[model samples]
Target chain A: MKIEGVVFKAGEVPKTLFKIVSGTVRETRNKTYHDLGHGDYVALLEYLLEEPIQENIVATEETEIIEVSLEDEYLNIIKRIIELRKVIFESSIDLEDIVLDDFNFEKVDIDKYLEQVESLLTLSAGDLPDDRDEALRVIESLDDDKIITKVNLVRSFIEKFPEEEEGARLLIETAAKVYIVLNDRYVAKSLLKKLLLHYSDIPKFCYEAIKTLEGIYRDEGNIIWRRYNKIAKILEVKLRGND
Target chain B: METIEFEPGQEIIKEGEEAQYIYMLKSGKIKVQLGLYEFVISDNNPEVFGLEALVGEKYTETCTTVENSKLICCNSSEFMEIYGKTEVSKKALESFMRRTAKVLGWI
Candidate 1:
C-alpha cells in the first residue's frame, strides 16, 4: 500500500509511519489543513518523540497506505530538515529587521572631491577674469543628482558677488527645479514668485513658472488651484491691458 | 484655549458658514460628510476641516460629533497665518488637493 497524505489536529494523538511508494502526499497543520495528493509520508517526528501524534492524518484522494514501526534513518532526515527550516526562518526575520532599521551608508571623502572639482574649474579658466562664460562652465560641470546641492553651491557663489544678476537668475531657476523635485510645491511657488518679481520681462521664466504651476496643480489640486486661479487672474488682467 | 464639548448629532461645522476656526479633536468621535460621502474618526485622530474654506472657497464638508467629543478650536485667521508659512502644511494641502482632483476627474 502507498501513503497519499497526512493531517493532524492540535490535540489528537498520531501513530503509524506511512511511506509513499507512489503518488504525492502532504502533511499540514490542522488549523491550515487542506488536501494532500499522493506519495506522501508521515509520522517521522512522532516516531522519534516516542509519543502520541498531536494531529489527524487522512488520505486527501484515492490512495493506499502501509504503517512502518519506528526506524533510525528516517528520524535523522526529519531532524536535519527541521534544523535547516529553523535557520531559514530566523535569517528571514533578521533580514526584515535590518531592512527596517535603514542602516546602510558607506563613508567617503566628499570635501576632498569638491576641492578637486573646484581646482579643475579654476585651472580650466586660465587667465580670463571670472566672466559669465566661466560661471556657465562651472554651473554646467556640477553633478545634477540633487538639485539642493547645486542650488547651495550657486547660492554661495551668488553671495560672493551680490550684484551678479545673471548668476542669481541661474541659481534661482536651479533652486526652483530642486524644490519641484523635492515635492516642495510651496517653496517652488514662492521661488517662482520671487523670480518674477526680479525679472518680470523674462517670458521664458514666466512660461517655466506657469508649467511648474500646472504640475503642482496636477499633483496637489486642492492646495494649488486657488493660487493658480489668482495667478491666472493676474495674467489675464495683464493680457487685457496689452489689448 | 477653551475645550469645547459637543453631544452626539451636534453640527460642529455647517456646510456654508464662514469657516472661522479649525478644530482638533481631543477625545470622542466625529463624522465628516461631503454630499453622500462620510468618514468617521474617533480617539486621537486629529481631523482638520474648514480649511478648504480658508482659501476663499466659501464652503466645507459638514462635520458632526458622532459621540460626546472634546475639541480644541483655533481661529482660522491665526491658523492660516501659521499654516501658510509652513512648508510641510503647504505640501500636504497640495497633495490633498491633487488627489481630490484626480478622484473627481477635474485634473
Candidate 2:
C-alpha cells in the first residue's frame, strides 16, 4: 500500500483482518490519529466484536500488510489467550509482569519483584496510623500517572492474600478509590464487589467498600442508585459496629 | 424478577441489540451465538449471559434456547446488587461471565 491509500475505511464492515508487515499506517478513530509501523495493527477489538470497523486506516508511507483470517483456528487461539488472562487475573498469579495490550503478554521479573510486592501486602496499617499518607506512599502513590504499575501491584496483592482478608481488603479498597482515577473502573468494580461480600462481616471493610461504591455512583450520575441503595441496606444490617 | 421460558430456538437476545437484562440460566441448555463466529454450550446451572450489560454496553452476541429452558433474568444493576453479596456466588458468577466473554464475541 502506498501513502494515502485506504486500507480499511471507517464505518465499513470488517470482512478480513489485516496486519502490517512493513512501513507505516495511520489510524484515525474519532478524530484521534495513531501512527502504526511495522508489527502494528488496527481495529482488532472492533473486528473481534463484530462491530462496525469505525476507524480509517491509510498508509503513511509505502506499507505492506497480510490479510489475516478470522477463522475458527485463529479465533480459538485468541479465545484461549483471553481465557488465560481472566484465569490469571482471578488467581493473582503474576504472569511475571503480564499486562494485556495488543494481545501481547508482557512478562516481568516474577521471582524477585513479586516477592517485594508480596512483602508490601503484609505491612500493618496499624503500624503507620499517624502517617496514613506516608504509609500509602510506600505502596506507590496511585496517582493518575503510573496507574498501570499501581493496578498490577494491587492485583498481585489481592491474588496473593485471598486467605488473608485484611490484606485483600486494603488492596480492594485501593482499587475502588485510587483506581477510579485510572481507566480500570470495571476491573476495580469487580474486585470491589468481591471484597464487599468477602469481608462484609468487618464493619471497617463494609464502610470502605460502601464509600467507594457511593463515589462511583456519584461519578457515573447515580443511575444505579437503586442498586447502590440495596447494597447499602444489606451492608447496614450486616455491619457489626462503627458506622 | 421474572422467569421466562424459551421453547427451543427462541431468541432471548440478538447480536448488537441493546441489552436489558443479565440472565442466569435456571434450567436446560442455551446456545450462545457469536455472529456465526462461535456457538457456546451454556448448560451449567446459573449459566449467566448479558453480563456486559454491567458495563452498560449493548449485547455482544445472540443467546437462543437450545432446549426447553428457563432463565431468571434481572436488570443489570439488580443483578450486581444481588450477586455482590456472597463470596462463592460472586466468584462463581464472575468466573462464568469471564469464560462466556471469550466465546461470546462482543462481550
Candidate 3:
C-alpha cells in the first residue's frame, strides 16, 4: 500500500479485517493520529462491534497487510486480545505494557478472583439477624449523628442478610460513605471491594466503588494509585462480563 | 451539551488555546498530546477529556482525531453548573487521574 492510501475510511461499513505485516498505517479519527504497525488489526473493533468503521485508516508508508479470517487461530487470539483491551478500555483502565505475545488470558487469574468473590459471599457475617424483619427495622432506624452506630447497624444488617441482594445493596452502598466519615478507610476500602466484587452485575455500585477507590488511591499517591488502577480495570472488566 | 463530529486529523483543541468545552467521547478515537507525552482516548468507554475547561484554564494539551469521531461537547461553565455532581464529573476526575498517571509513567 502506498502512503496516504486508504485501507478503510471512516463511515465505511466494515467488510474485511486486515493485519499489518510491515510498514505503518496511521489511523486518524477526527483530529487524533495513531500509528498502527506490524500485527495490529485494521477495522477489527468496528467489524466485531458491527459498527461502521469510524476512523480513516491510511497507509503511512509502503505497508504490507494481509486479509485475515476470524477462524484463523492466531487471528482469533488477536481478536480475543483486542476484545480484552476493549473491555479494559471501557472500564477506563489502560494497560500500556500489553505486548501481544506476552499476553495470556489464563494468567489473569479471573477464576481465582471469582473464587475470592465467592468466598466473600459465603463468609459468615459475624451474627445473623434474629430474622429479616428485625434487620430491616434496625437498618431503617438511623440517626444522622450516630455515625459509628450507623456503621455497626449497617454491618449487622449485611451480616444478617448476606443473601438479600436488594436490601443489602441499599445499606452496603451507604456503608462506605459512613466508614469514610469515621476515618476507617481500611475497613471502608475492604467493604467497597467486597461490594463491587459481589455486586458486579450492578453497574451503579461498580461505578461508585471504582470512583471512591480512585479518590482514595489518588490521595494515597501515584504509585499506589497505579497499582490499584490496574486492579480496578480488571474489576471493571469482570463487571463488564457480568453485564 | 452538543454533539460534534470531526474528520480525521482534525484538531479538537490546541495547547495554549482557550479551553471552552469539556469533551466526552461519544464515539471514535482521539489522540491527546501534552508536551512530549501522548495517549489515545477511544469510545471503548465513555471518557471525559479537555478537562482544563473545567478549571477555567487554558488548554495545556492538544487533542486531535485519529479517525472520524463524535464527541459530546459541553461549555465548561455550563457543565460545571449542571453536571458538577453527576457521573460526568467522576469521569472527568478519572480522566485527570489517568493523565497524571501517564505523566508519572504509571499508566
Which candidate has the highest DockQ of all?
2
Give i-RMS (Å) per prediction. Answer: 28.2, 14.0, 15.4
Residue A202 lDDT in model 3? Answer: 64
lDDT of each: 0.50, 0.55, 0.61
What is the two-chain DockQ of model 2? 0.03
Which candidate number maximizes TM-score?
Answer: 3
Ordering by lDDT: 3, 2, 1
Which one wins by DockQ: 2 or 3? 2
Model 3 CA lDDT for position B107 = 28
Query: A1-243, model 1: which lDDT tens digit per residue?
Result: 643345444345465556544454443332223233333345444443334554465656556665654332232333333332232222222221223111111133333443454465453322222565676666657655645445445544554554656654674577557565666565455445544544556545554565555455445523334334444445556666766
Off by over 4 Å in 3: A1-133, A167-172, A226-243, B1-107
Off by over 4 Å in 2: A1-243, B85-107
Q: TM-score for the second chain in candidate 2?
A: 0.76
Residues B17-46, model 2: lDDT tens digits: 777888878888887765223455555645
Docking class of 2: incorrect
Model 2 lDDT tens row, A126-235: 22223444534544554555444554545555454455565556656566554556545554555555565556456567556656765564455332332444455555
